[model samples]
Target: MRILGVYLENIRSFRKGLIVFPPRGITVIQGEVGSGKTSILMSIAYAFETPTGGRVEYADAFATPQPRHLLRTGESRGLIRVLVKQGNRLFLLERVLQREGDRVVNSGNAIYVYELLGEGGLQVKPVLKLRLSSGEYIEKLRSLLGLVEKSGRQRPEVFTNIIYSPQFNLTSILELEPSKRREVIEIALGLSRYTDFRANVSKVIDAIGEKVKGVQLELSRLEDTLRSLDKQGLQSRVKKIEEEKARVKRELEKVVSAREKAEKELEDVNNDILKVNSVIQEKRGLISRLQQENRLLRDKINAVKSKLASYTQVLGVSLDNLDEATKKVEEEIRAIQQRELGLRERLNALITREKDVIAEENRLDAEIAMLERRLGEVESDYREKEGIVKKGICPVCGQRIPHEHGLRLLAELREKAAKIKEELEEARRRRGVVREERSRLRSEIDKVQAELVDLSGTKDRVREAEKLLLELKSLMERVAEVASNEEAIKRMQQEVESLEATLREKKEKYASLKNELNRLREAERAMSNRLSELEGELRTLNDQLQKIQVLEEKLKSLRSELNKLVNSREVVKKVADMVDEVSRVLAQETFKFVSESFTTIFTMLAPDKALSIELSKDYEIRFYYATEKGRGLVVLPSGGQQSVASLALRLAVNQALRAISPRLKDSTLLLDEPTIGLSRELVARLRDLLNKLDEEQRAHIVVVTHDTDLLEAGSTRVRLVLREGATQVSYEGELDKNYRAFVESLIEKPP
Candidate 1:
């Protein structure tokens, strides 16, 4: 890609300016120090270096203290718009930076790319407009410029390090450490894949080695388990255990037969016990029936005698006088009930009187409270009015008043306050009298309640006496009916005795059978316990045998897996070795090509010095010269030679890279202040070399320098002047007609 023109606004030392480049020749930008000569180049580089967003750290192409420092003093925002040409298509790339708080930051949509189509490439069409995020916009820009790196990542280093060399950092590639220099060169030449392939193969080998170790470890563990099984004589032990299990099983069978016999015997005993229990139960039932009849007879007799005794004790009367005693108790109970009713009536009247007193007390309290509230208001008013009187003003109205009138108002307020106080005192006295009446009524109510409670106790006692008299009357009626039951009771007792004797004999027989059944059950439980022990022993032996078999199988499988891992590891190791050899050979061939190019370019630039340079496989530069003794190694004689050598190395790498990558054939080469320390002779040689490079049309070359001698070689020489704190550009060489027109149009009206 080649830069057509660059337009900048509020960018370091340039308020507003545009520089249009020649189409296909060396354009030398010459100006005084700090005259914005370098600013134009920096702006173009900055446009491509703006982080389209990621963790990529590009070289400092702008050479500013910070991004915001690129903006002019007192300016809050800066813009760099570059017009790039790739083949027949033209693109406009824009980057915007603004000052944010204490830091310089890109605008939200900081990058914009557009394609110019239609006639004269003046029609603007949107290509990419995106915020600084995941690098999509920059990737598109790189694709347009053919600047995508070999690793498939869009890197700004191609422009900053390869195509455009920053001011005062022309030898940046040479100044890098050997490894870093090699890495940059390889990436530019699209040879980074060799390095990546080596690294990936190594990682794979490491992974395989780790897998091999794991498999070996597992195999070792399996082998150890097998050895342990052998040490324990597992096969023989299993056989012995099987034999023991068989013997235990036989014992269990014998025990099972014994248990069955015992269970049969127990069953027979249980049958006998059941038969005896039936007989015992029947006899016991008969005895219970006889005993129940006799108990009813005794309870009836006892109840009649108890009633006779209670009647005599409570009423001092026998069954003949029971009616008289009952009548007397009934009369006493009625008297006590009448007294209780009178007491209750008196208590209810007292309670009613107490409630009325409480109501009167509450009313008095309300009245007293109202009077007190009125008194408070009057007092407050009196105090306020007295103050008003002292001030000779009316309290109700904000108006002036005579002293005598104010005093009269205060007197009225005092009189009202005194009346409220007197009413309050009278209501309080009434409330006190009502409270006293309430207390007296409460005391009368309590006394009446006590009398009622005492009456209730006397009534309960009279009710009990009446109940006893009724019971005595009932006993007197039943006494004659209770005929002599002595004979019947004696006969029932004898029958119950006989049945109990028979039941006792049967229970004795059942007890003997139950003891025999218990013995048999105990014997059967022992046999069942032995059988369970045998079963447990058999299960244990079988588990041991299964474990040994599983171990043996695992050992066999592990040995097979170990052999497979070993074979696979050998294959991968061979592949890794082959990859290493291939990588070394590729690097050697690439280095040989770059070295030849470097030697040719360096010889051309410093033909008189007989300097022959060699680039090691590490990309280290070695300068050698012919000598009478032999070819010898030496440091560069001067800074001018070093500059030439560095430039030559850069150009050689660029050439080698372009030869490999056809897309970079049209790439631009930007050299900023390359003649800073070069002698006049060296500068002339550099000019000739650049002119030769330009004539060959190898790449578009743009040189920025203050050396007038170098300007002679440019087909288009541009001069930059600083005036009024702004940069102005003027073309100073014979130019092509179309290019002249293009530059003129850009000056008059920039697109």
Candidate 2:
């Protein structure tokens, strides 16, 4: 359960480095100011466990106006790889940082997680791509580290605090409340069954208490609501309404009969009107088509008149005029050929551009799909956090926060998902705009195609005109201008005659509509009179039915409220029974076991012979000296003895913990400056303490000391030197000479 080596990249004071440990002995990390000795432990903790306070060292590298940072300056990403030998197996736990361009955005670190086997093992695989899995990866790491919670106190916090203690934690822990102190004690001693079981039972009691209060409040409100309605009076009224309902239905049937007779008479009249209207509609359609044909004839007449005027300009010109006309027609044919060629080229170009637009549209659709999936995952994570909070636990710390604070954390999770949804919406809108642009592009391409067709027809007409002009030059006749003009006038008069006939038919359709309108008016007036009478009576009946329905709903709600009261009473009783059972178990078995263990540990840790700890069945702790009993060392005047006693208690706790979990073989004990406040004379005692620690070979002690006097004679010391803005580690005690020996042992025993 000790870290063999820690590899850090882009961490504070060290761009890339490793701090290696001896297989199973004390390895002290000593360094000057700014040498990153603390960073090594931090990196190890960060790699394998969740370290919460602020960001990691040099984290201001991912600075925004917002209070979020993930990396250090000059670092785009960071890595902390912790390699450990748990029992007989070597494993590595890696944590990675991700950055977006320059800034880190999201709630918490986007843990790039992986599980890797060492030089002698299998595959290296990442458990998390962008976010953590439930507990699978954590369980894998804990198993390798032997972090099984046989007692709940042996959880991450217990071992982590022992292995990575800073100066402030010691004093802060001493001043904590009794319950919190008890939590630390149980965890440190590996006797967490009572504490953990009690906490869980307390949570259940609290949760059920809250439910009972809410349920009782709702019952009170339901009773008040029930009182507001007259249930007995409403029941009597219901019978009267039912009788009246039948009488009204009978009277309504008679009115319905009168309405039906009137409807039949009206139907006969309506049929007659429909026949007339049908003929009118048909005549109108024919008139509309004839009007359009007349317009075409008028346009043709005007065009002929214009052509006749042009011919008048060529009076008496014969062969010379024919030659000019032939040349002009040829010129027109060449221009048409050039215009059509340009138009066809434009049509082809537009078609190609339209295809590009369609491709863009498809790309937008794919991008939108990806964004939606991303949003779904974010929303799913948010939902999971909400559930965790409802179960009375903090999502971030894995501890239970206050009820109100947990809800606030739930809101934060939801907001993160909302931000993802906002991004998804933005992508979808862009995709929508692209789709509309694609549609418009398709329409433009269609127009270009239609224009190409029209131009081809124009080109053919120009070529025919050129041939006609050539024929005219070969045979010319001396035509009279007056006669040509007279022929044009005759064609116009025939067009006028056709228009007049179509106008006459439209007038007949208008006359038929007028007659049908008169007949409809007469029949509609008589039927509407009877319809109104029946509708008035029906409205009255409906109003009464609605009133009766409102009362019936009120009665139903009161009955539902009565049922809820019964259910709530049963729930309160059941919850009370559970609370009593758990209390009884704690009072009987767990309390006696912890009381015995606490007294034994207290005796070993205290400096004075008179000091001892006492515990009640309720788990209340009282400390005593030779003459008096106090709550803790707070009443003691001597700081030196207090430090010694605290250390003893801490060691005894760890030893008891070690006895429980064999996997914690040679478990680590980290001290920032545990010898602080000790007298000059006590320096020898401290040295004796270190020597005694090695003699027991019970745990590995790593002390970071500013005082050079603290180092032991034979223990390994890792001197951390800061030079050229980087921290380097130097130690000359051991390498893996036993690597081959250990591997052979594996073949022999195969564990």
Model 1, 480-592: lDDT tens per residue? Answer: 43353444445555665665676566567656766765666675577567657756765776677687778778878777877887787788778878877887887787788
Which stretch of 10 consecutive residues in model 1 shows the poorest summed lDDT?
50-59
Best by lDDT: 1
lDDT of 2 by residue, 1-751 (tens): 6666666666777787766666555666777767877667556545554432334334211111121232445666776666565554555566555466756432233233334457644323444433344144455555545563332221244543444555434443344566766665555544555445556656765665666566566656655665676656656665665565565566556655655665565565555556545554655555555555556545654554444344334432233466666566677668878887887788788778778877877887888788788778877877888788889998888997888998887787678778877877887788788778778877887887788788788767656555555444332331233345445545555555555565566556556655655555554554455445545555655555565566456556645654665565566567656756765664454445555655554454344576665654334444556655543442553665556555554565566556656777557776666667766546556666666667776457666665556665226777888888888877745445464344333222222
**Poorest 10 consecutive residues of model 2 by lDDT?**
59-68
Show the colliding residue pairs in model 1: none
lDDT of each: 0.71, 0.57
Give the Å shift of residue 205 in candidate 2: 11
Residue pairs clashing in model 2 are: none
- Candidate 2 stretches greater than 4 Å from native: 1-15, 20-35, 41-108, 115-122, 131-164, 177-525, 532-554, 580-611, 614-637, 648-670, 675-726, 730-751
lDDT of 1 at 467: 72
The per-residue C-alpha lDDT of model 1 at residue 219 equals 74
lDDT of 2: 0.57
Per-candidate TM vs. native? 0.48, 0.41
